[model samples]
Target: MQLFIGNINGQFGELEAEETQHFSRVLRGKLGQEIYLTDGKGTLAKGVVTEIHNKSIQLELSEIQENFEQRPYFLHIAIAPTKNIDRIEYFLEKATEIGIDEITFLKSFHSERKNINLERCQKIVNAAVKQSLKAYVPKLNDLTKFTDFVAQDFSETKLIAHCEEDFERKNFKEILQPNENYLILIGPEGDFSLDEIKLAEENGFQGISLGHQRFRTETAALNAVFGLDWAN
Candidate 1:
């Protein structure tokens, strides 16, 4: 199925401006041709092209599916952005394909990169969702301070992945419960500072380990997402 993102209401919908060129010009979509549409909010529809213009492509919806392929578990990963933006973007794309619900870029004491382009990251994830045939789009949050993020109340299972051997840490796989919401924290290249780990523990976050081998900032974050995904 060739899926495009759009808002569908009742029996009609219109593609966004950016998608117009791809659908009408690039793809050479013709009037009366059938196409798929998704709102990235668990709504998928099959529609026929009704009108095609420079700014938009209008569709007459025929079939609609709600909660399309919704995952049973919710996985949210908050990690420090990598120095090389490509690595973090790679994580976002892969995680979206492997199934992730939300992401947050962290600003920590040991963080190498303190900023992120939310727009670019969102585009990567949106493309991944369509490529992977997923109806829901993962939520992307702006860079947040480590202290402030840790202090927030979350009902999901909270975990912090760090390499500090001095602190007792549980295996990430063992900490997961099927069909439950999870929020995991991955640190920077230097890993989370001891004080940061201690502070997170105080805020009801448990420390977790992703096995013996050490992974990069982006790798560890993806590992956390994959671990929860497979566990469920």
Candidate 2:
């Protein structure tokens, strides 16, 4: 079953403008065709095409499927955007496939890049969700300053990956607990500055290390995602 994304109960069925075009012209879907639709917020709806217009595709609700339940734990990563946008985009794609909950681009003191292409990153995530057949889409946050990003109220297990000495660092796998929300920080090419690391620690983010070997910004972020203990 092909799953299309739309705002659930947005007025004209579950189909949006782009979805409508794809249904009519791209997929050549006709009236009475069965298709699965998701609101991206967890609700799944079953519908059959009722009206196909140039600008809109309408569907008659056959059934309102069950809402999706995410993993007991949530994974939120705040990474410094890479100079190569493709790398960050790749991270978004793979992270979504692996079941990340939220992503935020951060501007660190030594960050090589300070801007993010949010629109393009979203498209990548959307494609990944469809490819992975996931019910819930990850939330993408706008680029934020390092200080501002760390100041958010997150009651989960928070960690920051950095390469500074004098601070005891634990492996992400060792520190993460199952069924608990987690927030991780990954720095840019130049990595996080000493002051930035201190600020994060003061703000409740525990210092951690992915491994001894150094990694790129995107690689470290993905490693953190994969290393999370999601069991239980």
Candidate 3:
């Protein structure tokens, strides 16, 4: 199945500009050919190409599926952006392909990279969604300060993954509950500061450990994603 990204709400819709290039220039898509388009908001549309113009293509919708391939649980991972941006990019791609509901780049006290190129990260996510044939688009947020992000009430299962050995940490697996919304925090290379951990704990966030083996920022984030998938 050839899947493209587009917002198809009614009988007629247009493909995004980049998608048009992929359809016409790369794939040589022609009119009347059937293709699938996803808005990345749980809407999967099957449509026939009706018109192809410069930098755009019109579609006549045949079928639409809402909540397409929706998962039982929602996962949100907020992780400190790694110094090497590529590592975080890899995590985003793989996590999206595997399945994720939301992602927020974190700027922690120990964070090496203070800024992130959200556009590039979003492109990677979009491509992964197409490649993985996933209907829901993971909600991506810009770089957020650790303190500010922690202060919000997620109203879900909240967890913080850190390497603070002095403080007793709960095994992530022990706290897994089916079909519950989750928000997990992954700290930077140096891990969350004692003060930051305390702040999180005070705000109802439980500190948990992914495993005995310590992982890098990106790897730990991905592990949390996988753990959630496995648990559910």
What is each predicted model's overall lDDT from 0 to 1?
Answer: 0.89, 0.82, 0.89
TM-score of 3: 0.95
Among all windows of 10 consecutive residues in model 3, the one with the lowest summed lDDT is 5-14
lDDT tens digits, residues 72-172, model 1? 98888998998999999999999999999889999999998988999999889988988988889899999999999999989888989999999999988
RMSD (Å) per prediction: 1.4, 2.1, 1.3
Give the total clashing residue pairs for model 1: 0
Considering TM-score, where higher is better, how would the candidates rank from best to worst? 3, 1, 2
Flag the better candidate by TM-score, 1 or 2: 1
Off by over 4 Å in 2: 10-12, 229-232
Per-prediction count of colliding residue pairs? 0, 0, 0
Clashing pairs for predicted structure model 2, backbone only: none
lDDT of candidate 2 over 1-232, digit per residue (tens): 7878776673236577777877788888999898877777776777787877888777766567554656667899999999988899999999988878899889889988878878888889988877776778899998999999898898778899988877878887676678778889999898899999989999988999988888888999888777663453
Cα lDDT of model 2 overall?
0.82
Q: Against the correct fold, how does model 1 do in TM-score?
A: 0.95
